[model samples]
Target: MELTVSPAPHIHDNLTVSKCMYNVIIALLPAFAVSLYFFGIGALIVTLSSILSCVIVEYLIQKYLLKEKPSIGNGSAILTGLLLAFNLPSNLPIWIVVIGSIVAIGIAKMSFGGLGNNLFNPALAGRVFLLISFPTQMTQWPRPIVSRWNYTDTETGATLLSKLKEEGSQWIEQIDIANLWIGNQGGSLGEVGAIALLIGFAYLLYRKIISWHIPVSILLTVFLFSFVLACGQETGNMQNIPMWQYAFDFALIQLLSGGLLLGAIYMATDYVTSPMTSKGMIIYGIGIGILTVVIRQWGGYPEGVSFAILIMNAFTPLINNYIKPKRFGNHRS
Candidate 1:
């Protein structure tokens, strides 16, 4: 008797790369809506301009350089565009935003062997490049509710971090935390509103697009560190500065001020740029948190989430190598 065996069953999930990216875009919608509500037409204009530039650049690079049809339909390019725009100041020149898109799609994403192979987050890399190239323009955040289309003489609003940097604790007392939460304060377009970011984060959690490990770890680390530092300051050991009546001000400064929420939730969690293992994610989150606090507290730049995330992205390969997942039913060697 001859017996024939069939091929083993292969399990496949319905999830596609495009779907994952689209989910991220959907998660970002609440933040986008909030930003538009606060910043008006300028925010929308900047976001659309960045998206258009990114798509056009990706198409050109794929068609001419890679000799393939552009995969703009995959949704990664749009995500990158949205993120790049979010990181930028709303009043940034249109041409500069276009340049940033080119850097993100062409140089950072396409040049590194395209989507899955890039070592760094393309939008972040592009933002860093722009920050270095145009320090004044990049840091000159526009006042909320101002129109980008029509140049108007509005007050040059300082971000929370800048206020701290320029005037230290004296300035901190004057800032309204409610305004910070509502995006009435000055900062990057998408990072301005803490409530909006948390809303987006909730959607991502509900959709199961990302795990809680990285974001929670990062936020906790920042909070704990800031608390410890604030305690030291209260005791007159850290900075010899007078303690504020409210001790939790530093924590609020950390949470509601800059790009920490945005970076921790979205940028630091990039699948291709972050570590694969759970332990690796925790460690990565901790490192980013520490670096961010260090930079914000002592380094030259007031905001450090972008630089911190990029630095952590560089170490992801090393993290994955050492923190390999254990095999099922395998005994320890």
Candidate 2:
């Protein structure tokens, strides 16, 4: 037999795209279930429509548009659909869900040469696109406990974080930490439930689907920075409350009340979009965390997670370029 020489990374593992993507889908189920339990028919309709739209779009693009083999079998389209739906209002019109799915798979994913080649997270790009174009429908969040069966005609309400933005720290009186944790607040399809998102985060960590670097970095940065901001202020609500307690509550609200957990755990850590090295991931995460707090506190929007992630996604290439592993026999440091 002839001898052959190949480049390094000579070892092969049993991992497949199918297994990895399916595991992610599995990990997302806890949050998805919470959305169903709270939003019911609305959630189901949006999810199915988004998934179907994404799958069909990818198939057609590969078959006819690109004249290449279909890649939807890898479940990237399905995953994109689920994530897009997660980032959207559950009561959004079915046609809008279709539009978002098309944008996710067509423009964000396929247009960039498919899965591993995309520069931005497809779901979030789709979300930002929808948010900018249809701000009214996208921002209308249906409150929980209204009805499981109600999809469209349900009463719309502002989220706690929005109230915080409008009414200042005083709105904290209206928000119960327990209700927010249990997913009874008004928000997007999957982002309202802190407990469910945490459960999903735990599963992803346990499965080794993602490392702790990105998520931990983003969360810790948000907490520490927000604690500093809280300590500098003297809101009346915190007068009687201990300083530490008030700061903790303020940071916790920043953490739990929006898509921070969702973005930190799932969206920001996307394999193709995030940094390749631990150091680079940390930098990426820190940027996301700081930008999120800045936007939440000063920017016009009440929530800044999706925008923050997309913005950081733009820097991922620069991060990877500057922070790379040492060469095999050319270590300079």
Candidate 3:
């Protein structure tokens, strides 16, 4: 074979879109397994139905509607399906999962020109849509393990965020940190557990699938803000806590509980929806963290990670516009 000489150095990445998607799927498996172990058949049904519905919708839209090569085999739709299910209650009806799948893949994704061109994170958008449309069903959190086998009739209860918002620091006195960390509380299928989300986060970090900018900034900002609010007596966020230890404990609980871990680690770091540069990513992360705390503390909802991420997603374009990446071969200023 004759050699065709070009540049002095040659480097092969060998990483394709499919490879990246599969890596993300692997990272997400820990959370999926945790949900399955906690919710049993309900988790299985919701996940499978959502995945199938998303794949089917994407297939039909690409093959018949969009008249493009079917990209369902790339696993984006399946990932979206899994993520949307993760954000929802395990006891939700199958029809609702289907609707969420449609909204995620069809509206939030394809409507904005698919995959790399979408505006918001499709799964988060679908989740917010469901939460708004079906408030009661969306907030119905089934107690974990206790309702492992049960689906619709599972024993349901409120999340830590709800307790913190309504009953204040009383949630700390009632529920210990161990239960919250290990995810024994009631909430969405995947969002309930901190351990599982951490595992996935570690895997993603190991595989270089995601960077630490967005997640770390978001988590740190949340900690600092909550610490200030807890220690400060302006609006009395953490009342009845005289000691500093108790105040820090409440802030820790707020960090580990709810969808903060899930959204910060996975949803907010979405490749197409998030900012490009490191500075932009930090700004975006800070915005999400602040918005999340604001919504949880004073906004109408107790859990605000989804809404926070979506709102930040809308600002991504502006962030990119101002904080742009350095040019390849151009020197200016």
Taking all chains together, each candidate's TM-score versus the true structure is 0.91, 0.96, 0.92
Candidate 3 lDDT, tens digit per residue, 236-262?
Answer: 443565657676787788788898998
lDDT of 2 at 252: 89
* Model 1 weakest lDDT span, ten residues long: 147-156
lDDT of 2 by residue, 262-283 (tens): 8999899899999999999999
- In candidate 1, position 138 carries an lDDT of 89
Model 3 CA deviation exceeding 4 Å by range: 1-12, 233-242, 328-333
Top-scoring candidate (lDDT): 2
Clashes of each: 0, 0, 0
Superior candidate under TM-score, 1 versus 2: 2
Q: Give the distance in Å from residue 166's predicted Cα in candidate 2 to where it truly belongs.
A: 0.7
Q: Which candidate should be chosen as best, given TM-score against the real structure?
A: 2
lDDT, candidates in the order shown: 0.85, 0.89, 0.88
**Which 10-residue span in candidate 2 carries the lowest summed lDDT?**
233-242
RMSD of 3: 3.4
Worst 10 residues of 3 by lDDT: 232-241
